[model samples]
Target: MKKEEKSKPKKMKWNALVLSFLILLIILVLPPFAGLPVAGQRALAVLAFAIMLWVTEAVTYPVSAAFIIALLTFLIGLSPPLHGAGGLIGTKTALEWSLSGFSSAAVALVAGALFLSAAMQETGLDKRIALLVLSKVGSTIKGILFGVIIVGILLALFIPSPTARVGAMIPIILGMVSAFGLQKESRLSALLILATANTATIWSIGIKTATPQNMVGLNFIEKAFPYHISWLKWFLAAAPWSLIMSIVLYFVLMLVMRPETKAISTGKDVVKNQLTELGRMSGSQIRLLIIAFGALILWATEDSLHPFDSTTIVLLVVALMLAPGVGVLTWSKVEKLIPWGTIILFAAGISLGTVLLKTNGATWLAKIFFNKFGLNSLSIFTIVAILTAFAILIHIGFASATSLASTLIPVVIAFVQGMDNPGTIHGMGIVLITQFAIGFGFILPVNAPQNMLAYGTGTFETKDFIKIGVILTVIGYALFILFSLTYWKWIELLP
Candidate 1:
């Protein structure tokens, strides 16, 4: 009886949830009544609700995403009817719009990528690669850091999921550190893990299929505009940025946390022993290696050498990976290993962003911002910088780079359209850098999916993340602006 009384009192205590509820109510009721178009207002209302849910996380991300589909399923009548599907708004039509995100090929790519990551872990292929690279890099702290980065780049090229990449790297790298008598919380441990985390995100912009967010941005362009950015073109524009940023990332890590012990001296021996323990690759490992490399070859060459889209090629590889006799993964094994929640989150974010563009909600939001701030008189440089800042700073509210890009890429596009007297160079320069910069999330654990995964390992604290994050974020943005003026201008791509 005493315990029950105490529990009842505890449950009765006030929480801050009432505020979120009030905010949600205001969004739902007031937006539809605003001077927005019927469709725009409804889309805006849905966006507001999504923002609240994402910020509070009162529910799991997937649940909140599911809520979006549920709400759109019922309340879609408030918006203008979409064309091409009976040319009217109805529950059926709304459901289709909401479900399209869940069904997008980008989401499938992420799912397939997850299964492939599971394959590496199950077949011990990831460990073998890690050991092989670390072994060749020698015993110096700098060399080992580079080794960790090399593993990250190699895995990231094929593994689209940052969480999956980090998931694979963490165990192998941590095991290696353990082999060397390093503690998880030490500077070296932190450096190694941070290198892994940093590279996982850094490579997102380098490869077309490297991250879902990149695809999300592409989706926005297709939905909002008539132009196309091919997989090869995206890589062409971003490869240099990625290469330079990678060098910068490595330098930043070295500058921030100079290891007390300059050289491990035994790293080679540790690598030798780890490789010896791993033994020769199994048949499954060899098969997975071939499949992994094959997928890479197709993705890299598809734009020039073939007609299939990136997603189609990815799905083909996935089908091959699970084929009965030649496959690397069993359905039973992948079913358990896939990050379904993230897949759902990706779907929801894409859906919301897609609907926002469809309903003209993104355009309305931009006009509102411009009117409120009197950005009407701003130059293209100022406008692009503000948008860039928004693109980067907005990560505070979202943990997934995919979600952040989906939500803001459309906004960035709208702002680009708003610019006046923009020459080809200025407009394209601003647009490309603003969109490309969205791939990076260096601020908080919730800023990037990988950050949260790295935080889970308990190797580094929030403070550790902030210091390095600031250095990278600042330099990254600065480099972006400088490149726009120099290299990008010289190449005539911006012009």
Candidate 2:
């Protein structure tokens, strides 16, 4: 019996491996015969092959993605516009286009914001705020859920990147959960916290420093539209929707889990005791708060002075927080707190995007869809919104949000032009919708770093994520479509 069981598994593995290789061979050889652009076909084939490896767990997801990037860059080089010797070396024109995204301003801004988030986490400022909020409003499970939402929003303002924000907050959240005795079987409690944190990623789209995708949106709009949407205006347009979605998410969580009232009581009493243990806020905590608020003001008003760009303001804040006399930040601790993988992931995404756009792969794919469907501007918005939701749903196969964003943004921009009003407001609307939709990755343990962190606590199951995530995703998409059509018009940003 034991030998039979072992042989069965071996046979399955051999069959699966053979099937994958055959499928890969077919995709590689068939696309050229189908009259597809060689570069675009090759890019699609490579991406499909990577996805297959990721799904089968043949290799780690990031490793698979990295492999695709290397294969595309080295094997194919430049396609079509510069063929033969020109293609081998890459055309001067292609170099100019691809290198443009490597802007010093974008890199500095991202690094500075990352440093600030690390400083906050290292100094214990985020924990203090979480404790304070829980102490004030966590008497009930519902209250705790609301508190989580508020804390998540505040963190988003400072952290910007969801992976960083989620990672930094997970340990703190787990500490609180453990204190309250809310374990994995307490499904409702776990789902509520995860939903609050995940949904907050959408709200961060309102700020320039929120994520690299926001910056990409801004750059695309500046190039394609006659006007620019300021950070404040973008916030105004999306904030109401964010608030509404958060409330809906809270209620949906309650309905799905119907957690026993007893679970709420266990955590409340424990949290109160922990609050007593924390005592009053320390001097370091107070200073960190001031630095955080000051940084926000600078970011909000970055356009005012000629010399003070978003990058400069963020760097200044990081410097102040890290300064020796400040005592709020320690070099040794901050070094440990920083998420180096996230930074590298961001850089790689940017580089890959540069290659795609330079090689006209993005445009080629866009043209295929546009010609096949005959979609106009409004139709394009609908298509993009739907595709964005689907992308988020299957994002477990993706290693990083930046990776997903880099791959999708160009295609999104191509569709945006189909809209009659592809100006600042419409552009902002599309960007916000895509960013928010991407956060709907609630199905698997590995979908987003935050979900993975939350999963690690052993307080939730994959099914728990699916039940709540599905409902929230539906609500999110409905809200996105409504906001794009009506609210944006009321704000005079959409046609």
Candidate 3:
């Protein structure tokens, strides 16, 4: 009886593994039949499978992404024998294509910004800045919400990763809320703050290296447009919308959470005291500030000079931190600070995206969808925006913005391309907006790191999240469409 029971369990386990593999196979094989090329379709299949695994926690997110990369290289190379490598090293061209993102100047810029963010955190400069802002803006709940938006915007310029920025800010925001005697789970306030921070990072998208998706958009623009917008040009074009959105968000928060003046004023002294405790910026803070600003200047002007690339600049900054005079940053300390999972996941995502594009699967998908739908650029924009907003509604189910971006951007891009617009570059605005909207997953604690962090403070509830999040979503899409029609035209990036 014992032996029979054990055998039954073993059989069940085997059946489950076989079922999983079959599902993956079906997903991978189906795309080719749907008019996507085999290699590209297979890559999509691998990505879909990987995303499922990631969402289910069957494997870590990074692990799933990495596994997809390996599967793509093996499968794509074997079928086509990419440049005669016959699946060993992969076709030389395939290897080059897969690794292209690593060599991109934008990736280096983002990586550099990450290092700078780490340095700022190490010196406690970011915390000091947050306290300073809170002291000045903490007299009202509305003011504090505005303060969070302001702080998030400033941080976005320094911290490129939304996840990192939100993770860094949540503790400080929670502390302020606690001091105010506000319920941490109060849906309106907490959810608004999360949305504000995520929205603020959208402003950074105006800067060339502010986010990896920005790089992807830039790459697409260069490919499709006769003219390339420089970093300065890009910033000038998008900053106005960013500023407008930030202000709108501030008012929206106030409207949703009409907390009484007494509640708003309750925590003023606590925040003020925290400011006092930080005292003045120390020498280390001052030095790190100089280094941080210096790196930004270099990054902004990277395309101007032919000297060093963005990655080298980051490596140099990291190296300087190890210098005797700098003393604050050491290799031992700095190495431990890197978000290694993010880097690996980023590399894998870029690799997989490249394979999908290279295999002609993206193009093939584009052809079929475009042929049947007969949509123009405007229709494409509307559809993409609507779908993106819809995805934001369910975003809590996904783990990271990057994961969401990686999975969806390709499909959207293909859809836009299928429209076959002469002003295809204009489609980039849709891509940028979509990436930003993914940050809208504010209704659920699991939607974003900041949401999760704030959720745990026990002041807010799921109902609060849903209430505030829905309003933000409505307002955000309105702003997105308005920006798409007016601001994009003014910038001449759109017709």
lDDT: which candidate is best? 1
Error of 1 at 9 (Å): 17
In model 1, the number of clashes is 2
Better of 2 and 3 by TM-score: 3
Would you estimate the TM-scores of all the predictions? 0.90, 0.80, 0.82
- The clash count for each model shown is 2, 4, 8
lDDT of each: 0.75, 0.62, 0.63
**What lDDT, from 0 to 1, does candidate 3 have?**
0.63
Give me the displacement of residue 269 in model 3, in angstroms.
Answer: 3.6
Cα-lDDT of candidate 1: 0.75
Position 402, candidate 2: lDDT: 58
**Candidate 1 clash pair list:** 425-494, 425-495
Model 2: per-residue Cα lDDT over 122-149, one tens digit each: 6667776766676677567778777777
Candidate 2: worst-modelled 10 consecutive residues by lDDT: 82-91
